[model samples]
Target: MEINTFRESNQFTYSWHAIGAGLLASFVGFASTFTLIVQALINAGATQQQAATGLMAVSIAMGLAGILLSFKYRMPVSVAWSTPGAALLLGLGVVKGGFSTTTGALIMAAFMLTLAGLWKPLSRAINKIPSGIANAMLAGIILNLCVAPVHALAAYPLYIAPVLIVWLIMLKIKRMLAIPAAAITTLAVIYFTAKVGNIHAGDIMPHFILVKPEFTFSGFISIAVPLFIVTMASQNIPGMAVLSVNGYKPDAAPLFTSTGVSSLFAAPFGGPAIGLAAITAAICAGEEAGADPGKRYWAGIVCGVAYLFYGLAAGAATRFISISPPVLIEAVAGLALMGALGNSLMNALSDKENRDATVITFLITIGGHAFFGIGGAFWGLVAGLAMTFFLRQRQLKAA
Candidate 1:
């Protein structure tokens, strides 16, 4: 009887561990990127109300998706709005067509994602996209944002130094915690230094706003295509790999389909894109969540619940970001994305044979050199692929 009681007690501990892990995962995920999401939306031409609504919608979508996947699969299958996708938006900046057009682009991208799940050929084609080119494009998209710290340091050293210093300290101790630590530090900086006019009661709770989408060829090619590519290459594919590594391999089709479908629901509300997570998913699926792998679903469920709460409280986050000095929030965001940029550069330049093509892609993207209304991301991929094909043909002729 004592042995049995001990087993039950042990199981109880594991359950709580899962719960705690889930909350941490959700908090980290939200705090780390919520500001970026808002910034990206505003850059894409969303008004403050629309940007905050986008955050709320995406946060809720992420929560609901996590809950659905975890409960059904009995695993810690975490979901998140695409960080890289948001970065792509930031890189693209305000398109010619405006926020409604960006919304249309997002809806189209979500549709393509859903199709990728349902259609085997499309999925295979997307998966087969050269890692070097894809990574190079991602590296290019985020390259500028990654450098925001240097500029921010020069501009607001007094206010930003403490945040960067604390982030640096945490980076050595706990890499994952570093960004959130920076975010918290920024909150402190904002609270004490910045003059944010009175945050009314309504400012603490975000309200949903419907966005009417307008689709155009320019928006579709510039925003939708690149958004889908990054979300798939950087987030969705790696997200599945993370779960597989953690010994929880659910069907990728459902993951894609569900997130894509969920994104459709959120896009009208200005959500950029949604997909499975790469980093935070590992947290919820790892053994740290629970010893019993089967019970790790609790972590996912709790993470989802926490996301719902964050969604409701998104207005306060937006309020702080709004009052922040220009380049200040980007500084926090840049610090947060350093790790991703590092990984992307490593992957993009890893292959000696592909270095030439990869460099073309990276330079064009990072340079933000565009052609005829299209953005650098679209042109970078094109130029990279062309260079890759031409070089391969030359090699074949020589051989």
Candidate 2:
């Protein structure tokens, strides 16, 4: 009776704190990367309309997935579209089959992810992939975009200056605000100098556009496989780690299944894979969310609600990117991904015994070559595995 009374007494306080945490997490996550999502889709042959559709689709998919997972498990399990996966798309030169082909790839990848949840063996095999190779593949995928700020500075000094200055200042004040601040700064620069062009009523309101999926071998090897590997290795697994670090122990498979299913539904409308969130997971699951860990599920729920609102802003985000200088947004993306690149490189190089193979993987992936319709990402993984295997075999023989 006393415990129940105490719980009722603190419910209001808990609710407000959780709501605040959720809003903060959603704002930071969405503001920091929505441009990346829009620009990447366009880079991969999406028309502005298709890109906007994709943004809305992904935001809604992830938002719903986060809400469902949090409520069902009673844990703070925030969901997000794969950032590394988007980076990989940016690296992919326009595929032959265009956005519809990319849509087909999305379906296949999401299917595999959903299957992994249902089939233990597949999940274990995916888990068996070495972290170094996975991280290196990711680092390679993001390398070009991560260097865009330097290029932007060299090309458009006047335009890039305020964005970088604001980002650095925010970094000193509060790290969480840095990227979002830079994003906002970029918006101001766009407003004054570029003046977002040709924006209409349709551009301000989000809509659902059904893209016909086109299956091709190139699409499968280039888009589907790489997207699967990075989303699994970089986003989903690391998200689980963040939750674990926060002392939340929701079963991994169910969470994967739920997000995978959500991705499947969203793909025909141009969404990429939705998975567990790593950075935002930390925000929603952290102590700031609530005093009682058990009640933190409310944070995830609120984040999902917030993302649904962000989805409504998808058309506007697409318009901003369409008119703004490409290099400028790419610079913002580069800054946004600096932490990810550094983290991946650190992880890839940490395994001293595998360091050489890891380097090989990074070089091949960053080379961005294609052979027989297969892209550099797949070749890099293969080469890295071969190097690791040869080294291991030689060691066993010597011993």
Candidate 3:
């Protein structure tokens, strides 16, 4: 039934199904990527405390944003930490100015995102980016991380094999549960293989951490712009697509504006970047949430609420990650993202008009080359756009 009609029917029950769906999305997303989030923060020069705080901050930011947006708009508007942004941090290794500068970059990216919302031209320009190129860029950025399991297997086959076997079996049975199951298995494997001293059970409780941001020109150019691009093009755009597929066209500008503001609020506490969620969004925006689309917003709201609870345990999660083998963590994350990568590749090559340009974008992005401190993601887009524009001009001349 249509959303408005469902609203008219007054059948909205605070159903367990909706709540369960939300919780499931929350578990899958958080369990799958929280380790990566911590790893990214640490790599960017955050202290362990700062990394934990950042994870908590982003979780709360995304959770609150998701709840508010879904409740206000009466749609399943899910928000998430920028996974690509995390990957970008990982790829860049350590920034010169350390975590303080990285926080500054987060603030800058938030400001840019806010501008993208307030300025019609900026939003239009973002939309003007062809899907093929955007998808290719996302695929390229994540290519290395997705292949981590392969590398992990060669190094520690005994530990990784069981996890992989369970993940594959679960993928065949239930795709959503696949990553979470693997994550659980990974912890068990860590328990058996790693030294007992690695697991610091007492540090599981999280504490508030404050890190004052220090901005620099290099950080802005290298981190902020690319982050803004990835969050918008890769995360938020796909999130909107998920909503549209489930039949909802929200006012994008206001949503972006709200999320940007939330990110700003979170930056002081170490939040990296926030955007609409794509993968976990399907759980809340679909029939799994509710038969009635009007009621589906509750699922997103509950998911946000769940994130708040999860964020409360950020200290434990961070400590747990610290104990496990880093490669195993990367492998689990890579497995979770495999579905997204495959979909991106298919979309990137699907259109004959943009096929060549998309290939160029994908290749350059995966090459992992950077110039002037900027990453390959931006450069790949530049190359693909050049190819696309040249192809268009040639076509015009031919016609």
TM-score of each: 0.95, 0.96, 0.92
How many steric overlaps does candidate 2 have? Answer: 0
**Which is better, 1 or 3, measured by TM-score?**
1
lDDT (CA) per prediction: 0.87, 0.87, 0.84
- Backbone clashes in model 2, listed as residue pairs: none
Residue 65 in model 2: shift from native, Å? Answer: 0.8
Model 1 scores what on Cα lDDT?
A: 0.87
For candidate 2, report its TM-score: 0.96
Using TM-score as the measure, name the better of candidate 1 and candidate 2: 2
Q: How much does candidate 3 score in TM-score?
A: 0.92
Q: Write the per-residue lDDT of candidate 2 for residues 43-111, one digit (tens) a residue.
A: 888989899999999999899888877766777789999888888888895888788888999899999
**Model 1 segments beyond 4 Å from truth?**
1-14
lDDT of 1 by residue, 302-327 (tens): 99999999998777888778888859
Off by over 4 Å in 2: 1-14
| Tens digit per residue, CA lDDT, model 3, 1-399 | 334223445544676778888998899889878877888888788877888899999999889999988878878888898888888787676777788888898899999888888887987898898889988987887788899899999888998999999998998999878888898898788877767575565676767787888888778877887788889987878888888888888878888888888889888888888989998899999889977677788888999999999999998777767777778788877886788788888889996799999999999988867787666777888899999999999999999
Residue 114 lDDT in candidate 2: 91
Please give me the total number of clashing residue pairs in predicted model 3: 1
| lDDT value, candidate 2, whole model | 0.87
Assess the local accuracy of residue 211 in candidate 2 as a C-alpha lDDT between 0 and 100. 91
